[model samples]
Target: MYKFKILIEGYARTGANGVYFASPTSSLIYDEKVKVLVDPGTNADALRSSFEREEMEFKDIDIVFLTHYHPDHFLNIRLFPNVDLYDGTTRWHGDQEHFYEGRLPGTDIELVPTPGHTMEQTSLVIETVEYGIVFVCQDVFWWEDGKQKSDNVNDLLNNPDPFMASWKDLQNSRKIVLDRADWIVPGHGKMFRNPRRN
Candidate 1:
């Protein structure tokens, strides 16, 4: 079985012009066979420090998984140098490079589409002894009890961020994740037990 850790808890904020700036939550998934980094967000300094906190270094990372093509989520990705990456989209990069999908070749981890914040986004589903089922879902759900919105039980049902690619798609994706995830490491917040479930 695999285990995971939140390398960097993510956050997002809105400036003028509906300009959304985000810090993608980066997580580490490591098992006997592989070491993976999901959404290696934009801040290289922060990422380096997070690695230090875990007593790890850059080269230790094996696979880099991009949930979507957003810059903030992928900017620091090249730091790993020649490691394999799952570009998180079906179409060849708009440049013809293939994107990997389904259960990863050597692991029990599976990629499930959880779009809406962006049409091509995907979430990570892995079974772990410590957390049961963990969903590293990026952006489909914001912080618990609201992201930009005020914090409250309303956050449980108020929907994800104010900005999204499609509301209808997001709602459908959220239902699947919130229903199945034992715990979720959201795109822009600390990991939380599924509030609706508990």
Candidate 2:
């Protein structure tokens, strides 16, 4: 069994031609001693405030998880240099899936290569005791008005070419995780409780 302490901060927006934002948050799994600092996006002030509210120092982070390299999901990685970082290898060379075991003890946290949103994209998941299972899906899925949207987008969702493969991989990754996950943590919205709530 595993236990996790999760906190949702706010949106980390990227100032590009098209505005991009990420749900910058942090998760700490007590059993594994793993602290995942999700995409800090571009809002340094929000990030700092969130960390303080959670009683966590930026220096205490152990891993930085980048759902994708779209700036909104990264940009803040530079905040931590001492911590070991993990992102889909596809972000660097636009190929290959990086997998490992026991990246965190007592926790089955894996860097799933969920491309599509971006080639260098990845998602984080944890098998927990209380929550059963939770995933830091980032932006592979979007939730609005408590509805789920599929892998479809317009200019509102314009993506780069290198991430095409990652998008396809994202679908496949979703299938596997949906079957096992009980909590769906989106990168820019509220958390989806497994079995859902009325």
Candidate 3:
């Protein structure tokens, strides 16, 4: 069985372009042999503080999983050099390569493609004995105020030229997540019990 904890709860800010909520929501998943971090976020200090609060350190991290290439989510990845890293898209930086798609070898966490927030965005379906199936879907659905909102879809639909995502794909991805996830940890809010389930 695996246990997970939210390292940082993401937030949003308004900008001239409208609401810009890029603060990355990060989490840690661990069980005996594997200690994986999901989306370490942009603030190094905050991330470090969170680690300290959890009684953890950089040396404890075994792997890093980036939900996408967005700076807010993938920027602090350099902090964990000793671990293998995976990204939502295929890209390279010197010797470090971001995986486009794959499983984490021996882990129950499945890196499922959940595009629409971005063409490269991915979400994880972690099968846990305590939580059933917990879905870590960053930016796939934004939790704001006290309600869940499909901000990504709104962005794509409102734009004159929607290049990064499609409406149909976003809807499909939502269905997939809602179907499989019993609990959801979104990109910009607290963890919540998925109300869509029966």
Estimate the TM-score of every prediction: 0.84, 0.67, 0.80
Question: How far is each candidate from the true structure, as Cα RMSD in Å?
Answer: 3.7, 6.4, 4.6
Candidate 1 accuracy as TM-score:
0.84
Higher-ranked by TM-score: 1 or 2:
1
- What candidate 2 gets wrong by more than 4 Å, as runs, is 9-32, 89-107, 143-170, 194-198
**What count of clashes does model 1 give?**
0
- What tens-digit string does per-residue lDDT give for candidate 3 at 69-143? 778788888887666776655434558765545666557778889887787788988877777789998777764
RMSD of 3: 4.6
Q: Which digits, one per residue and each the tens of the lDDT, describe model 2 over residues 25-71?
A: 44455454656666666667767777898787988776666666666
Query: Which residue pairs in candidate 3 collide?
Result: none
Highest lDDT scorer: 1
Clashing pairs in 2: 91-120, 115-166, 115-167, 116-166, 116-167, 119-163
How much lDDT does candidate 1 score? 0.78
Clashes (backbone N, CA, C under 3 Å), per candidate, total: 0, 6, 0
State the C-alpha lDDT per candidate: 0.78, 0.58, 0.74
Clashing pairs in 1: none
Q: Which parts of model 1 are misplaced by more than 4 Å?
A: 14-21, 89-100, 143-154
Per TM-score, the best of the predicted structures is 1
Deviation from native of the Cα of residue 196 in model 3, angstroms? 2.3
